[model samples]
Target: MSKRMLALACALALLLTACNESARPQPSEGAAEIWFAVGTGEDGGPLVDGGGAVAPEYRALPDEADPVEERMAALLSGPQSAELRSPFPSGVRLRSWRLEEGVLRLDLSEAYGGLSGVDLTIADYCIVLTLCQVEGVEAVDITVEGETVPYRGRKLMREGDVVLSGGEGEPVAITASLYFLRRSGGLASESREVLVTENDTLATAVMGALMAGPRDQEELYLPLPEGTELLSAAVEAGVCYVNFSRAFTEGAPQSREEAARLLYAVVDTLCSLDQVEAVHLLVEGESLDRYGGVPTRNPLEKDYEMAGEEKPAAASGS
Candidate 1:
């Protein structure tokens, strides 16, 4: 993996490793049901209610075989509710599956590439959440017709691009306060309860959940682009340094005001963390003072609030 990708993965894994201060609820030991992040309603986006394990006890399979493949079979069955949906459509089939090191490698039919935009987003999460439940699997690598499909950018999702999903055996739940832009102004804080792995750091999971947006509410907006990667991150003292792929700062926001909102949506979300009193935003690993004229320097104090506020015409600073 490239240093950038490795750094990002380390950021996420380290988050889970470090955040063990308080007691975290363990995942269900008897995982009776598995959850898949499937698309719901016409405009409901992705909701985790898809498949609930094909067999009552997947861990007790009689034969010594690939357990991940068995879970994939259940996922292929699709969501029980008509309101929910899966990415594995009519022509899409799991051509093959294997587990290497900690990554679950998935090869699907060409039809898998048929999904795009929001549909693709829902589908990707569905597969990731479903398969990552198996033991020894830490991440998933997906391919279509033997080729790596370009997901959010030219860099195929080989590492950090992987979506962190809830495992089947059990789920760790935590509440986080994520910030979003409100039409009325002022950075609005929304408290969200999210499920993550035992190894997942609250900070990384919160960022992941933030990127997923405030669920069940349409008013709040996701600050980053669809394919943006949380390149790398670390929390020190009171400052949280989060790095994103180029996709974040490229193709600038429509205007300066919009840019400020985007920047704070990120700042406010991270600042919500008890350990984080400031936020430092970076693209790749470089600290950008400004992107397309939007001030993104960090150690961005809580007082530099986005709520009921707007950036000055000459907005620029950390």
Candidate 2:
């Protein structure tokens, strides 16, 4: 063939080869995607939004010796892309990890112990969302240097707790009838609408509102003392477990009447919800046998009359 004809044939052959390569299926074997916190840009992604948002990146899973461990290492190594960043702070390597009964417990180095508030929350859910993709990991329990944070609002982080809403998730607004002590004596209800996110349950929102005290402080008495933290709150099998920090007990009222009001304020507020048949009060996760004059060894059912015109007698006799 002539030189011109040979050149044209070679160009046509190259175009065909390029088209064939483009048509071939992309390889996805031995690979999985992991999430990372968004470093910049408008973030409405999963995780508790207070400027803490996350996005995902596709990466190859290391040789499948231990899938969970491998995936966690990949997350710790940081995202390959420039737009994403690891939520874990510097030097926060995984100290230990174990899976039991669908719960994945990850103990990170002491560097992680310094995080609190929104930063801690974001870092936690970042690990949760990334690791939960592995089989048998229904929830994540993260600790710093082998100990749970005493003041953490939630101990168990689940996939459902945060979602990839892509900036569309809206806060749920509920008008809860929160109970507070009446200045004169008995308890009274205040209907206030509070916004709750996917990360917060209705019980938690109500408990937080009660802790914030009533809007009309002059007419109502705040049962929960100031600086009391709601460690965690959840309902299981018709019982709402409300865990508070030690500050709750230390700041409790000394008078029996005042104490009873404080205890029942929490009980009645939680029981108002249909899912909670009774309330179980705990100070730092230990069941309180008695808080002042109230017997709380077992979950206490709500007292319909506690909020009546007159305060009912204490649940337990002094």
Candidate 3:
């Protein structure tokens, strides 16, 4: 035979083989169908079934274990109680937790009505003490409804009002007005001015003075309704005169008792300094009517009322 004829015959043989292979039956991609056998007592050996064979047993491997969640749950939910309750009236709920970057991200419910300016410092202490006790959690990032909690002044996760104690010493006392940033997504925070005092006890005395004073200025202490800026302090005629700005009486707000409390907060703070026997309120270098009903004294009470006197002016400063 010619070489060309032999090559054509070989090509035809290869084509036939390919066609035959393609036409053969193939397995379906779907799951295998299961079959069961029925007993036929006639065999008497054990029991014969109509089917040829039985299906193989399916045993799935065990799932991976999660120790973090279990441990955290045990730590947070004490053996006595299951749900954690807030000390404040606001009903805050803790939802989920995740550890990342050496910090615990605690997801909370939306029901958390944040604490106000004065209450914020106390709230921070509560949250930090509770979460820090858990193992492997040194810091926390609070999230509400899947977003980071927002603060008014700074980052909520790491910053707060109350300053932690340095090393082994007691925590120092400080006070500041708290604000919240809704867009931030965590909690309200505040920036405070640190007042240097003689000791821890005296530091608290200074904080009390700041809390009772106006938001804009730190030096002057005035009645709640008064917007007075404390200019200077002088001792004359056995009285410590506190000179203040005339803007003090534009549109201040406070009852007679509230005004008296402000007076006492100032007097108490000043009295802590040696050689100050009495304090006198002065606006723009002029003496003002008494606050509440009586003159300030030790353990000052809020009963100051003028004799046949009219209501005081308001504060205008923002």
- Count clashes in each candidate, considering only residues at least 3 apart in sequence or on different chains: 13, 0, 25
Runs of candidate 1 with Cα error greater than 4 angstroms are: 1-169, 292-294, 303-305, 308-318
Please write out the lDDT profile of model 2 over residues 209-295, one tens digit for every residue.
666668888999776665677787777777889999998899889888899888999898787654467998999999988986889
Worst 10 residues of 3 by lDDT: 10-19
Q: Give the per-residue lDDT digits (tens) of candidate 3, residues 84-175.
A: 22233333556787887657776666643343222333344445444454457667666668864343233343423334322232223333
Candidates sorted by lDDT, best first: 2, 1, 3
Q: Rank order by TM-score, top first? A: 2, 1, 3
The per-model lDDT (C-alpha) reads 0.54, 0.66, 0.37
Shift of residue 268 alpha carbon in model 1, Å: 1.1
Per-model TM values vs. the true structure: 0.44, 0.45, 0.34
Better of 1 and 2 by TM-score: 2
TM-score, predicted candidate 2 vs. hidden true structure: 0.45
Per-residue lDDT of model 1, residues 1-318, tens digit only = 454433322232211121121322234555423333332222212222222111111223324556676666667776565534445546577898777898888899877775432234445655665566667877777889878865423222232343333444345333345677665655676654444444334355556666766653667665566568775567766677787889887855767777777777877766644346688787889888886465566467553445643422432453
> What local lDDT does model 2 show for residue 251?
88
After TM-score superposition, what is the CA distance of residue 42 in candidate 3 from its true location, in Å?
92
How far in Å is the alpha carbon of 186 misplaced in model 3?
28
